[model samples]
Target: MRIEIIAVGTELLLGQIANTNAQWISKELAHYGANIYHHSVVGDNLPRVVEAFEQSRKRSDVVIVSGGLGPTEDDLTREAACEVFEDELLEHSPTMNKIIDFFKKNNRQMTMNNRKQSHVLKTAMVLENSEGMAPGQIVEADDSTFIFLPGVPAEMKSLMNDFVFKYLTEKYQLETKIKSEMLRFIGIGESTLEEKLKDLISKQTNPTIAPLAGEGDVAIRLTASGKNPEREIADMKTSILERVGHYYFGSDSITIEEAVQDLLVQKSLTVGSAESLTGGKFIERIIQLTGASSICQGGLVAYTPEAKQRVIRVPKEIITRHGTISSKCAEEMAVQAQKLLHVDIAISFTGVAGPSSSEGHEPGLVYIGIKVKDAPAEVFHYYFDGSRDKIRQRTVNKGFELLFHKLK
Candidate 1:
């Protein structure tokens, strides 16, 4: 079924509130194999709302509208629907009684405008709202189904779960299901990953492959529509992993830090960090997850040469010879951190994240060090381009990326 979602609110257009209702509705409908062709946002003006409804009714098999259903004067969605469908407005007696009971139960005086919530289309099926005062409505005309829901997120979700899902299933006889899976990767660029999977992407039909660039990583989303799509999706994932599996970290909703935490718990290993440019951000991410106290040994933010020498005890001679942004300094910091914090693994970050040069070195020049117990320290160098915050954020992600591979 071709479905179009329309959001009615002046706040959405004015950037006062987000139009999250449409996003949630689209996700829910797509699971039942419904095609969402367009999303529209119209202000609270009556004429514009009528126009939006008229356009959607002509082209779409299903029209789902959210917002503009309240007791205030700006609530024009009910009136607009009546105009577009050429239906009469009538008072829903059951809904009116419910509203009156709610006010009496709360011992509050009912205003004249509150009665507006009880009015709905004459030919529409009334959906009683248990969460709020305004009721939802469903109108069927000329082979089109129109659903009007509340703008409040909690009320809208409650109605969808309580009544809408089962109703749609019974009326449309929904059978085929749409499923999507995400494959997350680090230590690889988006362009390179796409080039590696060009052949499979070109030959795609059922399950389409889409590559998306995230904050500091890359992801591939696979979407399939069928009665049973798990096997086909697994096969496609296996094919993609065969070519670029080394760069793959985890799947949907799994952050790199969480992946590292899982690996650490499995291996029964403890970790620590010594920060210079990242300022404890690397370890901060680790402790954000639950049960981190079991694996984290804490970290030190040695932002300057003096702090590195005094707190983490990086040798003063190394800093004097190679400076703080060098591989030698980073390696020393990691080795010292492992010794002081008594962890199985230690990582260090030392970089010049700036818009200006430091110590005759250009901005975005960074070195990261990793040292495992009884093993020689390894240092990696990178040069990034962006603002100071971006450079520092990327440094933290790269630390997790390196740790993920080492733990594997």
Candidate 2:
């Protein structure tokens, strides 16, 4: 199926915020084996929106539009859709009653403007929006299907996941199932990983390989389309893993922190951390997982030399002799954290993540320390190049990568 995404807003053109809706929609539709050829952004201008709708309807089988389904004057997506489909706007009573009940429940006055949200195309199937006030509409006109959704991302996603996907599946009776696996790799650059798999990528026909660069790591998305493509996909995955399996940590939507926590839980081992450059971000990521409290002992964010000495009990002499950014300080911090938290493993992060040099050391200079139970502490050094946030993020990722390997 040929699908086109149209995002309606002026703020997108003005660079106020990104059109993340289109990106998200395209990825979701790709799972259904839909071919998304065009993504368009149109300001809240009626004529242009109408033109975008017309163009999409002419070339695409399904047109998914986000935004401009509000109560305000500039919200004109439904209006423009009416013109293209030659449909009349009629008020949906259930949506109007829901809006009224919402205002009454909130103890607020209901304005006439809000009534605009209850309108839909005369010949459209109203998709109830559980997250917001505006009800979505699915209108079939001529040969094209138009799905109008509220611009609010949460509402749009809820409708798409809850209703539209099932509707599309039933209507099309899709025979070919599209399956994808995301193989995540760290400690490797995107270009280097691509170069390593260039032969497989070039010779790909059924199961295609695409390398995607992320914040602190890279991923390869392997997609296959067929009634039964599992064995072929698994074979291709085995081939790729044979070459670069050492750098592979986890799979689709699995963060490094989640991977570390899973390993800890499986081994029944507890972990703790003493963070400097990354602050409490290391433990913060771990605690975001559901069962993290069982594996995560504690964390300490000792930013200054004084804090290191007082809070986490890093020896003052090490800071005075080697400074806070040195391997000695990092090892001391990890060893101290292991003693303080009484965990099976401890990690420390000390780095100069800055836009300027600190203590005669350049930015991105980092030292990570790992101390396992009844074992000597090990320290690693690295230098990364990026903004302060990027350097800090990389430091945290490297910490997880090291821990992942150690736990393995």
Instruction: List candidate 1 stretches off by more than 4 Å.
Output: none
Tell me the number of clashing residue pairs for each predicted model: 0, 0
lDDT of 1 by residue, 50-155 (tens): 9999999989988989888899999999999999999988889998999999999999999999999999999998888889988889999986999999899988
Q: In order, what lDDT does every prediction score?
A: 0.92, 0.91
Positional deviation of 83 in candidate 2, in angstroms? 4.3
Candidate 2 local lDDT, 1-408, one digit each (tens): 888889999999999999988988877876776778899999999999999999999999889999999999999998998899888999999999999999999999998999999999999999999999999999998889999999899999999999998998788776676778999998889999999999999999879999999988899998888877677689899999999998888889998888888889899999999999999888898888898889988899989889999999978788889999999999999999999999999999998999998878999999999999999999999999999999998899889999998998
Error of 1 at 396 (Å): 0.9
Clash pairs (backbone) in predicted model 1: none
The segments of candidate 2 whose C-alpha lies over 4 angstroms from its true place after superposition are: 9-31, 66-75, 78-173, 315-317
As a whole number from 0 to 100, the lDDT of residue 209 in candidate 2 is 94
Clashing residue pairs in candidate 2 are: none
